[model samples]
Target: MRAALKWVLWDVKDTLLKVRFSVGEQYCREAERIGLNLKPVEVNSAFRQTYKSYSSRYPNYGIAQGLNGHSWWTGVVQDTFSLCGVQDPALLQTVSHNLYHNFCNAQNWEVFDDSKKVLEACSSLGLKQGVVSNFDKRLEAILKSCDLLSHFSFLMTSEAAGVAKPSSLIFEQALHNCEVSATQVAHVGDHYINDYLASRSIGIHGFLLDRDNKYNQSGIVPKEHCLNSLEELPSRLQEQMD
Candidate 1:
């Protein structure tokens, strides 16, 4: 039954690796470096609000509306600080620029301890792995700096695909790029709707990585499809395929 699954697609953020610093802490650090005294907690809250607003109004980094990752994220940073009462356009620009470039390197991210093991295990099982994430073009650089880029045969980012999660087009593009049938692949990610439901909607086996037990009682995803850690993945795939 191992032949039933030929590929394993993964989601990057929150599944494989995550930003090492909290948005609030990182933003404050950058802001403080420019001689601005800001509270991390307040900055973080403002960032969350600004992020949700941006995601709703301009999904996929506004790729559909002709905005790229740099433009979209720059707007977010500028507005996040604006919400915090930083009215200096020059200050906003400087902080946003610093934060944007700061995120594209390894110092900004930390790989989950279980991630490498799972990737290696899947490789040993003869399964090809690739990325399907809602990240921007900077993902390749970030992954490379983290030493995780070599594992995947391909990387599909929403900005590059011109489509994002919760939309089946990105997954379809991933399949097309990999030249594989939906039945031959499985996708693992942390978001319930974007990762699990989205991939499954197109006949791909979907697994939800619930490292924090956030979905333990959501009653939305099936228990079998939910994993506490990626370490359960290879064995879980075997069980499902068998």
Candidate 2:
């Protein structure tokens, strides 16, 4: 028989934290504040598109990787601003960079309500909680500051693992951190292709968490077992208990 899962690993960002669009807003606001004469919507839209493009281009690198991954997004903003006939690329990037950096270390870290509820339940049931994410190393400090550190057995990031998701080695490392075999742990995440399918490929239980209605576009619909919020996990546990 297989071991009942003793570990619960988290996917950071949208799964646990309420992602804010404020950084994008701040970029536009800063631009306007200094007479850049650009529309906020344009700035925000460009940032989002560029952000996805950058992430798609480089999955392994993150924020502290010296803007190596998402610099393209910043470049998009700069280029667009120039196209819109705005002067001062340096000021725009500087303010935007500061806003992004400050957001990374912000004290008012917004956490998902579901994340708190389920983590509490897991603890009560004696499951070792952990976080494994494709994020920068500063994730540790952010978790610590948000009071999420203590709840986690260990926080694993791409920087520490030296690899990103959709790769088997990272999942293997996450399992090792929890001292469990792939068959024994379940990974819950928002991205179906990256987190769910990747982990599932390696024999771990992978659950797709649909928060922003992403499943509709993922082309791989999540099953009923793939929940919308962590609050639903207790019923699964309750059924197992029964």
Candidate 3:
């Protein structure tokens, strides 16, 4: 018989809450406010390119090797502006600060329509819930502002754990925090590697939330482990328990 899942750990951004604005749009708006002229699309393209390049070099490389969240994101913002032909150091700092603060506001984000129902169902089942995300410390404040703080018993960030996902350390920390063994926990998130494979590596059941059906073509996850929506979660777990 399979062990019953007692804890449902979650990844916050892109899983429960979606940012209302794209990084490029937010950056461009902040830049315009600071007297810089740039189109949203242009800023978006540059931001994507810069972010992709950074990720390619260091996957989920946040708050490690003496780099804190502010410094890490400041570098990203600087690189983004540099790619967009805005190379002024002081201006980059100002734009990055504005962009960072904008993200902390709950108005800048929206919870997925299916998220609350799933959380409520899981809660009614008496399952413990918490957030295990690769975000920074600001995630706690953001979750609180988004009205999601009450649903979670704990929030673990990359900054707090000193390691990001795809590393077993963070998942191990989550297991420790929940006071459960690996087999007694299940994690759900949007990313294939960071969410699914990472949790699975440490024996935690992992489910990928592929709401758009985009991952069907990639074959990164077995169809059984892929969920198209959070609404399916409670029933899926119940079926497993049965």
**TM-score top scorer:** 1
- Kindly list the per-residue Cα lDDT of model 1 for residues 1-242, writing each as its tens digit: 33378899999999999989899999998999999999999999999999999999999999888899999999999999999999998999999999999998899899999999989999988889999999999999999999999999999999999999989999999999778789889999999999999999999999999988878678777788999989989998886566
Instruction: Rank candidates by TM-score, best first.
Output: 1, 3, 2
lDDT score at residue 223, model 2, on the 0-100 scale? 55
Those runs of model 1 whose alpha carbons end farther than 4 Å from true positions after fitting are: 1-3, 216-219, 240-242
Better of 1 and 3 by lDDT: 1
Please write out the lDDT profile of model 3 over residues 6-54, one tens digit for every residue.
Answer: 9999999899999898777778878988899988888888888887886
User: The CA-based lDDT of model 3 is what?
Assistant: 0.86
Model 2 — which ten-residue stretch has the worst lDDT?
63-72
Query: Over all chains combined, what TM-score does candidate 2 have?
Result: 0.78
RMSD of 2: 3.9
Question: Against the hidden reference, what TM-scores do the models get?
Answer: 0.94, 0.78, 0.90
Instruction: Output the better candidate (1/2) by lDDT.
Output: 1
Q: Candidate 2: misplaced stretches above 4 Å?
A: 32-37, 62-93, 106-109, 212-224, 237-242
| lDDT score, candidate 1 | 0.92
For candidate 1, the 10 contiguous residues with the lowest summed lDDT are 1-10
Question: On a 0 to 1 TM-score scale, where does candidate 3 land against the true structure?
Answer: 0.90
